[model samples]
Target: MSEPVVGLVVSHATLAEGLVQSVRQIAGAEADALRALSNEGCGPEALQKSVRDALGDGPGIVFTDMPSGSCAFAARRLTLDRDDTAVVCGVNLPMLLDFVFHRDLPLPELVDRLVSKGKSAITGSCREVAGHGDRAAAG
Candidate 1:
């Protein structure tokens, strides 16, 4: 069986390097994470080629740093007309960590779980102060 792959796409090579380091810092040894990014003097096509070369006909997931940027676009193109691979943008620590943590799950289930976790990770807090600020004074 092929080893499961998780790839990252970034706008710049330096960013890609940092992502590799950060992913390892967060995920430890749970996954084989690779990266593709636009080089200092290159363009979006460079990112696309990087992804294609790294994936090389494998069942893998690609995560891009931006939802509507070159990196994301490249990943989308790479996985076009293919289901074995998934291209997900909005890459963040939570999502990447979740992917590695749940690597053992079956693909379909994993995807469902990841989406749920991703949504939950985003927060928008709006509430009145509780015991520490209001309720204690009220009661």
Candidate 2:
């Protein structure tokens, strides 16, 4: 069997850690396949080292909170020469949940699905729904 794909969440401050905790609460046992790292007070070099240490030598995915921030930059730098690595920025609960469910997919396919799911999850409410109505309209 193929080695299981690993997941790494990288973000500024405590976002990465918090997201992982939330994922654990929501996903239960499935969240065990993931890890989180924060660029709290570390420089690029230190952050890169942390990511590399987390990644080890296996096929993995890195999710960042920002596309151009330090976390994404470090992740991009680390995966630049490695085909087995992929970095998906703008991570959210939807994306992480998708990863939790789809971590066994091939690296490239998983990255594609993550990017699509993450983008699709970002939406604006245009009208009232069954359980979700605009509070301003109600008040």
Candidate 3:
């Protein structure tokens, strides 16, 4: 098999580490390919370098906690000229779990699957779960 697609999770404070820790706790061996970086004391340039050093030369994804946050900005900047890597915002436990298991897939395919898995993991409201609009309103 080819080299597994690794991931660098970047988040504010200790969020990144917490997510990676959770993945390690739950996924065990499968979580080996994922790492974490926090933007706690790092500025844009520093964050960028930290991410760059962590990623090196490899086909991987950078998972950011927010779409418009420092982590996302840094990751986006670092990967602008690279095709082997991609930046994924809104990092979460479900997404990380998906990444750990499906790392062997091609980069593009892996990105698609990770995004899909991440989106699918999001859910809210019991009313929405049951039904919405006229049907739920009447019932």
Whole-model Cα lDDT per candidate?
Answer: 0.65, 0.86, 0.87
Model 2 poorest 10 in a row by lDDT: 130-139
Give the C-alpha miss distance for residue 89 in model 3, angstroms: 0.4
lDDT (tens digit, per residue) of candidate 1 on 1-139: 4456555545544666666677778668443555545546646777678777776675677766667767777778877766777776666666667777665666666667776777767754345544245333331
Model 1 scores a TM of 0.70
What ranges in model 2 sit over 4 Å off?
A: 30-32, 126-139
Per-model root-mean-square deviation over C-alphas: 5.3, 4.1, 4.7
The candidate that wins on TM-score is 2
TM-score of 3: 0.86
lDDT of 3 by residue, 9-86 (tens): 999999999999999999894544988899988988999999998987878899999999789999999888777899
Ten-residue stretch with the least lDDT total in model 3: 130-139
Off by over 4 Å in 3: 30-32, 127-139
What lDDT tens digits, residue by residue, belong to model 2 across residues 1-139?
Answer: 5787888999988898898998888888364488999998899999999999987788999999988979999999998877789998899998998888888888888889989999888766554453465343332
